[model samples]
Target: MAVTVLSVNAQQRGNRENMTPEKMAERMTEKMTEDLKLDEAQKQEVYDLNLESANKRTEMMAKEQTDKKAARENMKADQEAHEAKLKEILTNDQFVKWEEIQKEQREKMKDRRGGGGRPQ
Candidate 1:
């Protein structure tokens, strides 16, 4: 059930990024009606909810992406400023753990891309 909700949340985000509002609504309606077996009223409710969530996530992701891009651009400058501090702060083990966590996150994203269906 949790996975299904998360999948819906991700789908909402993808719809926001990939399609226009009208198309997103139409697609959501179709999915709710056909795939989820929802009725007209339920579909409308779901569509509205999804659309609202999508808008919020889209804004947040856009902000995050912008922030990330800026951060990347400043990496060299920041590294020059903070490399010594970073090395003092994080030991080799911590860096290794960070890499592992990033790998796990990438795997989860890959699963989401693959429809987020039941595990095979």
Candidate 2:
């Protein structure tokens, strides 16, 4: 049983390690589609947006960042632009729900990291 659990965990970790931008974008777009009930056109748009964002993120992570503040600002700008596009694509109600979902996920991540309001 212990060996089986370890294998499963290792498999999951390996999947994450092997994920490419295309695969990451597809997974993200699928989740958004399920959550927001996106139409075909919206799904395609979201997938494109996700692909672009994923590629950018992969590029950023690959580079050796020298300035932490600049990196943070860049990430913030990218996030804001992404949300702006999403707002244009999603309905107001869906946008609100998406924000709520994001908030919940952030909270979960904080908890996982043993965070007590760490500064960004």
Candidate 3:
């Protein structure tokens, strides 16, 4: 039973690692649609934004193999651009809720890292 559980966990992790930008965007869109009660247009726009962000992240991950600092800076810039786009696309209330969601996720990540936050 333990072996089966471990194998399933490993397989899930592998699947996540290999997920395409479209798949990631779809998942994010679905979640955001549910959380924000988004309209069809909002869902479509969010999906596009999410796909673009995912592709940028994938590219940054590749770049990180060669230049960690440069990759980090590029990632930050990309994130800021994405956030700007999101602010433009989302309603003010939705944007505030999105920020709260992001803060919650960051807190969860910090907890997962034993409260250390990101390594500098």
Candidate 4:
């Protein structure tokens, strides 16, 4: 659910930096709906899952982390769980496509940021 819009539509948002969790979830869900051909129920499920995940991430980001490695591990674990739920919701082809999209987006982010992004 909280796929990070993977940075809130960097191209169109332009100078803007920070979007509320709800907005981020909406945008992420919209992208999934378009790319994955999600039905109404799936969209709602994805939205709720995304909103919940984003809210948790927002809170996690606000806290100070003394160990970045631990934080990254935790994030990875959560993402795995999210992906499991998503797999249950999507068809096999859709899930594969979703992973491809995520990988492509990650590559785009790395290109934009000079290789600054967490590894999966």
**CA lDDT of each prediction against the hidden true structure:** 0.57, 0.91, 0.90, 0.85
Best by lDDT: 2
Q: For candidate 3, write residues 1-120 as lDDT tens digits.
A: 999998998999899989988898899999999988899998899999999999988776665367677777888999999999989889999999999999999999899789998788
Off by over 4 Å in 4: 1-17, 115-120
Q: Name the regions of candidate 3 deviating beyond 4 angstroms.
A: 1-9
Work out the TM-score per prediction: 0.38, 0.85, 0.87, 0.77
Q: Say which candidate scores most in TM-score.
A: 3
lDDT of 1 by residue, 1-120 (tens): 999998999998776678765666577557545644555665666566556544544455456565665655555444344334323434466445644655677788878779474453
Candidate 2, residues 81-104: lDDT per residue as tens digits? 999999998989989999999999
Which scores greater on lDDT, model 1 or model 4? 4
Which structure is stronger by TM-score: 3 or 4?
Answer: 3
Q: lDDT score of model 2? A: 0.91
Deviating ranges (above 4 Å) for candidate 2:
1-14, 117-120
